[model samples]
Target: MLPRIHSKGNYQKQAQGNATARGNTARSHSSVRTTDSSKFSKLKEVLVNNLLKDYHRKNKKAGNDAIYLKAVEEVEKILTHGRLTDKQLKDLQRKFSAMDGIPEAAAVSDHAEQDSYPRRTEVDEVNSYRPQPPPTASTQTSPSKRRKQIDEWSVMTLYNDVKHYEEQKKMKEKVKNEQQRTREELAAQIEERKKQKAAVKEQERRVADEQRKKYEEWQQEMKLIENEKLQKLLEERKREAIELKRAQDRKKMQIEEDKKMRARATMEKRAQYEAVLKENEKVLERKRQQKQEERELDERLFRVQMEMAERQARTALAAENERARREQDRQLRLKAAERMGQEMENKAAEVERNIEERVQKAQDEQYRRDMERERNDRLRHDRIVKENNAFLQRQIQMQEEEKMRRKEEERLLAEEMKREAEAFKREQQRNKVLRHQQCMQQKAMLDKQRMMKDYYNENESAMTEIELRLNAPLLKQVVQEKPDLPGELASKINLN
Candidate 1:
């Protein structure tokens, strides 16, 4: 078994040496096989190292530490396996390229071709290692050097073919990764929208509850204010009625005192008039007696009769004067009573008018306040509803725009995928053509080598007889010509 080596520099050295000596050296089959195995191993080691470095450099900033560790583990496994198949190399290439956008290792073109040309295993055969030959005296290089150049060309061609396969695999994997990422992003957006809807509903419910609570509180406050106003108005009206009653009673008492003083003055004037009438009656009697004595005896009886009639007339006049005074006193008493009643009626009417006016004023004020409060509440409710509607409309518009943008992105992605598929198909056809050409060339070379070996085997005995017949005369001639040669030349020929 071949010893496993891990160092990069050593792998490179071994690869260079094996590649240079591949088909140029004249060595046994076992020696050639060993070199081939080592060459393939070195290629795998170099490819894995490059992939690892690229992955680390690109993903380090992204913080994909676990992914990097897994990659390292996978690389270790491949190295320990001691052999890398075309399929395994392709798989690794896809994973490495997709993970970090780094290019993958060279691989076989197809599964069928990979199975046909499987990697060779290291055998336990003991063969001596060969060193390259030194330059000859001739200025021209050896045929072995020319053959080595051709072998190197073939190896490079094989590496290019494998690289093409790896590139194709990586591209496919990268596309798949992009599609998956897009799906995840869409799902996250949908979840976010749902959460926003739930939150909006909760907010609206809270707002409605707050409004209801405020309205109820406002109603309670208004009721309290109205009740207080009613109490105050009732108390004020009661105070005003009491004041009016007190004023009416004061005026009525003043009118009654004035009537009593007038009645007493009228009684004193009647008694003074009666005393004056009595003094006048006594004087008139004395004058009538003197006139009778002077008239003489003949008319004495006639004068006495006249005096009696005069006394009767005087008595009737006194009776008529007394009745007129009594009738006048009765009329004055009736007028005073009527005036007092009229004054009382006027006061009662004025108080009624004042009370009606105050009540009407208070009712109008209350009605105006109620109207203003209702107007304010209506305006506030309208404003709140308008704001809510506008906000909902804006949210809906934004969601629609986002959906349109996502649709555009998906459409573009699909078109890009279609283009990639077509390009991949064309590349596969081209690689198939190239592989076929290389296969034909190899078959032709192998056929030519087999024909040359058959020709050499078939002509061997005949060529030996012909060469003897031809050399007999040359030998005779050389012997004859030997006597004419110099001593050193002759000695050398004799020794041979």
Candidate 2:
């Protein structure tokens, strides 16, 4: 009972502790939400500034400057109010975006002589307080300068966050300390109560012990008085007992005489009753044996029927498990076959396309080679014909020269032969250049053929290896739990 009370107190304290912890958690979450909201407001400010800058750039008319100033003034006024709900903030942002440098027209159209900032409840407006922005801008600049300013703003925001974090940390620590102090006070009070209870229980036990001792002393005195009265009564009772014993002896003799007379009268009747009781006992024994045999037969029939039903149920369950296993296996195999078929088809098409490209390239190269050979043959035939005609003319010139060998000047002849030598040397150089070009063309063609062969062989080997892997049997898991298939099921499967 004492332990139950202690546990109850401890549970109550623990529940309080849980509640305190939950409150702290909620406060922390609320603070986080506040910080997020502050960050959101900062982002909104930056977005609005950027929008203003863009608007100022697009609408550079002198007439629109007043409109732009009014929009900025109204946005600043909206910010000067207390914290806005998401709906209000969204409405303000949407209105600003759709202003189109015409805030007065929209404001007047809705409500004449009304400002852009909407009104709120009087009590709430009285209670509201606004915090100033870190900074405000009204002009455009190059992106680099704007980016630098944004960086500075980010650092400022970070510093503020750090300060807030420190404050929250201190608050959490203070809450924790307060909770600890309360728990300690509760524990001390509980301890004091336990001590007080112990002192009271000790006093109660001491009093009970004293009362028990007093009761024993009173009982001893009463017993002595009872013993004296009982001794006097015992003497009186002894005299009365002697008188009653004499009267009982006379009554006993009369009862014995009456009993003997009754027994003598009923002797034949007693023998008849004994014979009937023995006959009844024999009939009851025969009936008991018959009932026992019938009960045994019924039990045997019930046990046999139960055994057959159990076997049938187990057999059907095993059949169902086996059928499900077969079905799953069939589905798995069908998926594998389909996937492999697709992979094979893709590989075959890729190989066929590659082969076609290689064949086309080879045919083009052969045609180019045939055309080059035919052009070379025609050029050789023309060169030979020119050489034949030139040789005939040279023979005629040589005969003329021989005739004029003694008649012509030696200087003129020598000059003519030198010119012929130069012409022949030029022709030989051109032929050498042509041969070099032909050799280079053959080398390039050979290199292309080698590269194509290498590419085709590599692709074919890779595809063949992939096909082999796909054809390979997948690794199958072995079931250690052997199926308890019915013998009849196995026989039927074998027959099918």
Q: How many Å off is the CA of 415 in candidate 2?
A: 99
Each prediction's Cα RMSD? 44.8, 75.7
**How does residue 229 of candidate 2 score in lDDT?**
49
Per-model TM against the reference = 0.23, 0.20
389-480 per-residue lDDT for model 1 (tens digits): 67557656755775686577657756875786687568657766865775576567556655754664454222123223423444345666
lDDT (tens digit, per residue) of candidate 2 on 1-496: 0011122355476456556646644532321223442554443345345435544445432213334345444544555442446676566556545556555566456444335556543222211212433433532333223221224445555555667768878987887787567666656766676687568557756755675565567557646755764576566456656654664565466546545654553454455445544654565466456446555654565455545545545554564455456556777665555565566556555755665575567557656766775576567657755765685576557657754752454456457657755775686577568657755765675566557556644542231222223222210111112245566533333333
Residue 81, candidate 1: Cα error in Å is 99
TM-score of 1: 0.23
